[model samples]
Target: MVQGRIEKLRFIAEEMQIAFHLATNLTDPFFARTIARHILVRAENLIAHARGLRRPLRDAGFDTNAFHTAKEAYATEFEEYFKVARHKIGAHVQDFDFGKRIELWNDIEIVKLSYFVDGAREIYEGLAALTVPGYVPYAVPAELSDPKIVEILHQIQRSLDARTWVEMGTDSLAMARGNTSAVLNTTPVHARAGQLALIRRWIALQLELRGKLAAYPAIARLFKERIVTDIVSFCDCLVTRPVAADALQAMDGLNKLVQAENQSSAAIDDFVAASHFETDLAATRRVRDKIGAHLEIDEAETLPMLLADLNAFDLDKALAFYDRVAAAFNKQCFAVLFLRMYAADGARLYGVTMGHSAVKPFAGVAEPPPAAPPALPLINDEQEYAKNLRRWLDGDENQKGTARDFFWKAFMGSDSIEDIKETEHFGSGTRYHSHQFRKAHQFLLDALSDGLSDFDFKGVLDLVMSCRGGAPYPLSEVLVRCAPHAPVFRQYLICHVLGEIGSEPHESVSDFFDAQAHSPTWAVRLEAVMARYKSFIKNEGVFRTNHKGQTKVEHDALVASMTQAMSPDERLICLLGFASVHTGPLAGVFTTPFNSNYTALQAELEMLILPLLNDDDANSKVAMLKQLIQTHDYVGVSVHIAINLNSGENHPLYAALVDACCRGTIIAASNNQASRHLAISYVMKKDHRFAFEIAGPLADRNPDWIDAQILVAQILGEIVGAEADARKRVSSIRSAYKLSPMQEAALAAVETEVQNRVTRQEE
Candidate 1:
């Protein structure tokens, strides 16, 4: 059912991207407005579908936590667009109030709309990848064969790729100058790979923009400048730096460092004219900053206001500008590429001409590479095996039997551990597919069986360790049955398999791990502890799936063994595993009478885990504490801490709670500042001790966090009563600080009440 929803969402999301493309790119205002309205409606629909898809995705055993967060953020930004573009003007309303006039929004706003569409597409694609076959490209279905459109698309991609180089090139140029500008400024090959990815995405968007629509010259001009600005920013990253302004110091410094730098041909100033670079970059920056969608235009003005200046967007002049800018960009790409080649060749400095020759093609218009002949014959055993596997998986059900038979025979025929490892099998189509090839447990067992006589224990162990999805039968039973007969492989299995053991159905299996818990090897013992905790969680309510048939008595025995022998760190894992089963964005989703039985156990586990915080390794503790605070039981946890503070039974781990609260408060504030403020108020009402602990940390940070301060003040007034001295301090604090009108209004009301109390006292 979830897969069906995800598939439906992907289809809708793909159509939305197409609508957005038509909306933004069409030169005809009437058609563009029509398409834009369609996009807005589609966006609203897509959001509703995405929200619906979330729960199903989570229940389908996919983690939707991070995806949901990203979706919410995208939805929020899209909502504002929906309000303005659709609700107010585009589709729903033809008229508006006198105060507001509907002017077509700038191209910059259109770009942002495109980003939202891409964001939605990304989420849908990611979900699809989890359950679909092969690469599902987010291809924008459009016809864009015009030369003008193709040229513009390439230009956009080249500029986007160049933007990545800017930051890296700037850093390299600075370091080069430090080394007297002689050193090659090589970046990692990974950086190039990353840049290529950006280029592909940019290509996708630009192609989408070239849908069957007339190009608007004004919008195109603006887009060109945006691209140029990005390219300039890359150049600027190299040139922009802190420098001494005083002439004497500048000259003196130049003599000391500049002279040495001038001896080398790699100096940035030698490659480009500083004055020209500065002029072009500054011009582009001004247009991007002042004219783009990020900044608001005056109410009376529109985008065409800039075109009133005759030379502002002259097509002829832009062409000339492009040539000069493109050349400079090419030179920069060459210089950076040369540095990389130089480094790779053991710092063999090719002369300056060699750098120019090599980098020239990157700067020019890139031509498509020649297409290779299709259907190359399989060249190796690995290639042949992979080909046959994919063909079988993709072929008919009847043909799949041939593939399965071939795979099994290959496994049985295998003699060495290496050959057994090389054996491939596709267990069933119901589970995994060509996109992700995970062999069945039976196939792995067969492969292991083939090599067991040759003492291929390592191969068996490797296969066991690779088990992410549990085996069809108990892995614990298989190990138990094999261990006594294969003593040579016992130690290897003992070390590796213990971590993979999710549940123990039998006493012998439980005893096997229980005895290993006391192993001399700390690593082996730690693995056993983790395996036991996993077993406990899976067998029990947490996850509520994948049961390991262990009775309460057996489960308690495992916990008892862990508590008696495992270290604090190991216990921390057990505590976290228990908490995670219950943790989520909302509480009470899985509430049953069974929860009451585990409440005491949960409390006891929290107590044991909390005190073990260390300055050296508090990352895990901090993370666990944050997760605990986010859980539905946060109110319970907070109340527990407040009770502890009230009784003056402050545990050493109380500081960790404070840290968790502070972090949670920051996240909560971003989502809802009122909720955070009210939380502070609630704690203050419970115990001033708890309230002050939270309020003190919040106060120490931003004074501008007036909501927090206002709540803190209100809480203080409740705690202290309306004393004259307290009123004076509040008045003094209000006057001393700068406050926004809203803050002042809130403070004024609080002060006026205090003044009233003071007057009554005087009367």
Candidate 2:
């Protein structure tokens, strides 16, 4: 009878445990409510059963001290609450009286219930406020309502069941099967191996899963559809076979350890009994045997069908199971290997623990330390290159070949001429051979004998161009070196190369130009003069600006470097280059148009160039104006010239210049040239009539040009009785374009000017 009562109590405890587990683990809110109700019912039942079992066990001559202790604790903590909960709320809900209910809101009507009053608290409070004579305000104790009550009941059941097991001789039977304290005759080496093997499998599974997860996105991006499909299939195969198989093998290894340890505990047994492991392992083996290990002809088991079968295997649950099992072994037996450590450290730890070297031995003596890389020769200076070349030519064939290989690798990054086309210094259209090296050698020998002549200059140029890879020696260094020795006519070729390459202009190149600028040959002198300005304009950072203005240090350094006295033509070229710096691509983006720094720089440059523009030489003035028209700076330079033209004398020249600047492209009126036109238009506002004449055509031709539209509208407002027309035109332009703050300011200025003009006329 006592045993039957104990069994009944155990059964109640197990039912409550199941309800509690379901309540916590199940995620559906509706199901959660159902499980919560079930847990309450089960908890009430367990309490009743435990209360009844105490007396029967005491009468059966069993020690009832633990039962008395549990009963006392229940009475002190949960007895009154459980009574009220069972009698008034849960089991006897029909017996409790509730006030007439009004339907305040329904779930469908309420968007969110949390926004309303706390229903449960209100119900309890209302119950407490009832005018019953002996009623005490009571809330269900947290302990009774909590799922943890089920755990307490389970512990009591376990204690009672353990005693019952002893009374029924089940403990002895388990002892007979295997003594818990018995030591194996030998260290369980095979069991340890199984443990390590399981760890290895786990590590492999983790690595495969992590690698595929990380690589799939990038692989999908970089590969074509067919290739991506194949790669995805490969990844799926890895996960389906190797990773899944590893999980299965890890389970088997864990089971082997349990068998080898010859000890059984509830935790380890619970892990072994988990049905998901068996289900998943069976599904995994089917995939491995049919699709992965062998491509079998089974229509019933397709790859997708087999893969879908694995959906039942929860990898997170499996990992938790393994961790639980390891913890159980650590507590019950000797310390087990830390599975996480093995998975994290990977094969390095495995090999070390297994007494194997981490590094695999090579088959032969390690390849002789790689031959030292060849150093680039110091040939930046022409004199240095000449000395090096003379020494190389004087050497025997082997030395000469070594020198050639060094130069070839330095210039082309490879000694073989087969890769010459691949070098950045060479173009696809140019075919080269090893013989070019020989020709270069002969040319250098000739040039060193008699300063480089026109005939041999081509060979030298080819060599210099081929070797211009921006290494220890670059095009700038080579040009500076070779400029002094290059023939007078070929100096222009060097200048052209320097300009084309766009490297930082070397000071020595400038000095060479200064010397050649006075050359007796007119063509040489002309080339030298132009090349000097070109080199200065192309120098790194010469024209680079931020939103502020030109980089002051670079601008100042460039100005200081202009030590050579300039002719009127040279000064014109400089002005053209400087003026265009602020008008390049996205001119307003890099430097604000007409910012103070830019205005100051312009004033400085105008002081130098305006006098030249007024030179008595008509041919020179015409030549300079034509040069400006042919370059990118034509609009900017012409605008500057037009704005600064003296009021009386050069008005015709200014008009002609503006006409030439605006001649070719109407699109320029709406684009980069718009800013320059806007500047000139603002200056011409002093003479509103002239401003209208200049800006009217542009505004009419490019109706979208906001600056021209604004200027024309402002000029019209300045004229008598055109106020309404100006207001209508300005409003239309403002509506059409999304004006920048500056453009908006210009529009605002136009309005202010129009208002002030009307005021002045009225006065």
| Winner by TM-score | 1
Over the stretch 1-763, how does candidate 1's per-residue lDDT look in tens digits? 4544554455556656655554444433322433455455446656766787677667768777777887788789776656555543332222232123223222214555667678878777766546633325666544332356545545544543332111122222122111111322223322222222222222223334433223644334333433433333333333332346553212111112223433332334432432244444555555544332122123233323533432264333333333333333333334454323222211212111111111112112323532543332232345445544544546654344344444433433333332111122223422221111123323444444443534345544533444323431244444654554444335435434544444334455567667667777544554556555555544443434223332343445655757665555444444433343344221243323236535756666566645543413546544654465445344334434433443232543343343333323112222223245435535534565556555545543333344655655654554445355445535534633455788768767767766676677689
Q: Give residue 465's lDDT in candidate 2 (0 to 100).
A: 49
- Global Cα lDDT for candidate 2: 0.40
Clash pairs of candidate 2? none
> Against the true structure, what is each candidate's TM-score?
0.29, 0.22
Give the poorly placed runs of model 1, Cα more than 4 Å off.
1-148, 151-516, 519-527, 540-554, 567-594, 606-763
Q: How many backbone clashes does candidate 1 have?
A: 1
Q: Looking at model 1, which ten-residue stretch has the lowest summed lDDT?
A: 351-360
Candidate 1, position 63, lDDT: 77
Clash pairs (backbone) in predicted model 1: 166-234
How many residue pairs collide in each prediction?
1, 0
664-723 per-residue lDDT for model 2 (tens digits) = 211122343544454353444345565566667655434334566677776777776777
